[model samples]
Target: MLSTVRRLGVRGPAVVAIFLIGLFAIGCSGAALQGVGAPGATAAPGVATGDAARGPVEGDQNGSGNQPPAAPADPLIIKTGALSLQVTGLDAAVTAATQKVDGLGGYVSGSDRSGDGENASASITFRIPAARWDEALAALRGLADKVLTERSSTEDVTGQVVDLGARIKNLEATERALQAIMDRATEIKDVLSVQAELTKVRGQIEEMTAEKGHLVEQAAMSTLTVTFSLKPNPVRTEQQGFDPAAEAEQASASLVSVLQGVATAGIWFGIVWLPILLFFGIVAGVVLVVSRRFRRAGPGDDTPPVAPEAGSAA
Candidate 1:
């Protein structure tokens, strides 16, 4: 009977633990759905939502329905700009840009200078307060001799910020549920399982929290990249009288080159080509002499008396 009672005791707590986990799961899902469907359900801390989250009423005499949705009170915008300028001096332009950014409550993030003198150029990256983005750009432009190019862009991440806030909220609820379960857990296995789940939920919370913070920081600051290049130098021409001494030196050099070429030709003919030509000439002369002797013998010399026929001699 004691053994049977012990078995029942173990099974009772396990059943209760399973039932509680199921309840928590259902609750978390319902909360998540409600957060998604409800307007301004899980707004992040310090975010405004009064007019931004409200939609226009139907059949309003003020024609509110015909109007567009209201913009977010605290919109998250990532602003960036690029400017190319032709300046008289790289160092001076860079210095002026630095001062301008600082005066506008901004700071230089990075800077690079390459080449020198007429070919000098500089690229500077600045992080400016979003409120002062336009001011910083104008100030930097004023330091340039000419504006080569200018561009600006903005990105809205309000949706992502809101979504992260919702997820972090849901995860926190899950964590609380897990903590409650761990506190009520009587069996070692139940306790360990709850602890593991709690750790996972906390980790997710930290990650999402960090991501939201980064997005906020980016929206608060704007980035501007300014490139500075030296102004082009003007063309120049020089006029001067000819020099007799330089002409004389050039003429002497040409004459020496001609003499050297002639000498090289003479050496080649004597040492390399002359022997081959002489050998071929001697062979031709011998062949001609033999041919002439044969011709003279055949036409001019008397033919030897025809040998008498044997029968005529008898």
Candidate 2:
């Protein structure tokens, strides 16, 4: 009986004691009944209370409780930026900057030029070895003019990292707890509940793990937005040839102006005073002839009336 009770699990010891008590009570009751000469009153035969006493121990309270699992720390938040520059020149500077990064085991993430005309600017996202971000920023400043602008930022991911770690740990603990329940569970409903909870906890763990991974990645690599301008330096100024197309357009406009001037001259010559010029010419010619006739006629003042000279007398 003792061995069988022991095989019954955690509640076996207490159940054995209770069964012993019941037996003692029954023996005493039987003896008294015999002594008093009462018949059929010894003790009612009943199922042992030990069976009811056998149950799960307080396993959850003290056995498994330990110091709570600590969460993994998160990476810090970091950022940087620089002056605007020409895209072509950006390669050299970015190369130089990233070289500094490589020396520090950093890398570039994004690079692009945006807009057109003078509004154009180049932006690059680079990562620096976390330990050497300050050195990298110093190197980046060296690539710009006056460091026209500079910025740095930090976000405390310690709390968030710890939080994610805690959440993930909690999910794992919940999974273990559910496994325990699942092991002992007999009812289909209890099994189903444990399975569902375990599945949910596993999913939560995965999600938290992914989040923590992303945070770690971001923290491990520092973000730097490098903006550079093709510095207007005489030393590095590249001589630019005149735009052929613009020159051609200007030539065309000059030709058009010449044609326009010719057209204007022609119009003025034709429309300005040709009719008045003809009138003045005719009047001058008449005056010259009359003067000549008068001069020929010497002292004769009536020389204009001498037109009927030869055959028109009839």
Candidate 3:
């Protein structure tokens, strides 16, 4: 009975005191408690902090804190030229053009020729530094007896170069992101997937890098193709008395020229078909001798001598 009464007193006093304290606290801070979550009320500390963290910052959306790089002062330009020239001697013109290119810190990239002497023509391609393109072109033109065709072209590649730069930057960024993902991957499937994406991105990056290098190279060097044609030299005639010595000299010179032409033609023929001709000639000679002997032989020699009549007595 004493334990029961003690428990009852303990429960009654605690309940009464909590009720009186709650009533007193409500009277003092009732407004603040009601307004805590009201629509027009100030947000709680946790909610305000969350909203502040999620809000956008003041700056450009591109996320780069710095400005873009400035464009180049000079546009990336590739220059090319084609020139046709008439000259007295194609060989001399080719030599002079090559020497000029060498003097200007350039090199001959290609050379081809057709015909000979008066009808000869040469095609020479030179790679000259862009800085000396004009000077080199002018010098090449000056080497000709007459300029038949001259053409020059300039291509601006600034847009392509700038595009490559931007693309490379974005790809590099993607590569970094992919690398991070790959590092964090745990499962085999996840690793394989990330590796494939990384490889693709890296391939694109390499291709664009190579393209940029090619563009830069083209811009640095200019191509010049010159065609050199040889024209016949003017002939001069001299008038003088008809002397016997002069006539004999002219006749001898004419004879020599004819003989030289014939010798040249024979030499070329032998060089081309001597073996085939000799084989055919040998076969023809053997056939001629055999035919002559057959004609001279008696009819019995042509007939195979009737096979000794089956076993005719010896």
Most lDDT-accurate candidate: 1
C-alpha positional error of residue 207 in candidate 1 after TM-score superposition, expressed in Å:
1.7
List, residue by residue over 1-314, the lDDT tens digit for candidate 3.
11222333334443333233223222322121223212344433432332243222123245331112334567889999999999887778899999999999999889888987578888999999999998998899899889999999999987666556545544554455456445555666667766786787788789878998899888988899999997657786877677999899999999999999999989988997797899999999999999999988846545555556656855
Query: Which residue runs does candidate 2 get wrong by more than 4 Å?
Result: 1-66, 69-88, 114-120, 186-188, 233-314
Q: What's the TM-score of every candidate structure?
A: 0.59, 0.49, 0.54
lDDT of 1: 0.69
**Which residue pairs show backbone clashes in model 1?**
none
Candidate 2, residues 1-314, lDDT tens digits: the string is 23333333425456454344334332332131211212222222221232234322234343322123343343366444444334336557767776777777877788887765445567778877667788877777776555666667777675566556544533454455446546666666666765775676677678778987887777777787777555443465678888999999999999999999999988887887777788899999999999999888786565576578577776
Q: Model 2 compared with the native: what TM-score?
A: 0.49
lDDT of 1 by residue, 246-313 (tens): 99999999999999999999999999999999999999999999999898878454677789999999
1 against 3, candidate with superior TM-score: 1
Order of models, best lDDT first? 1, 3, 2
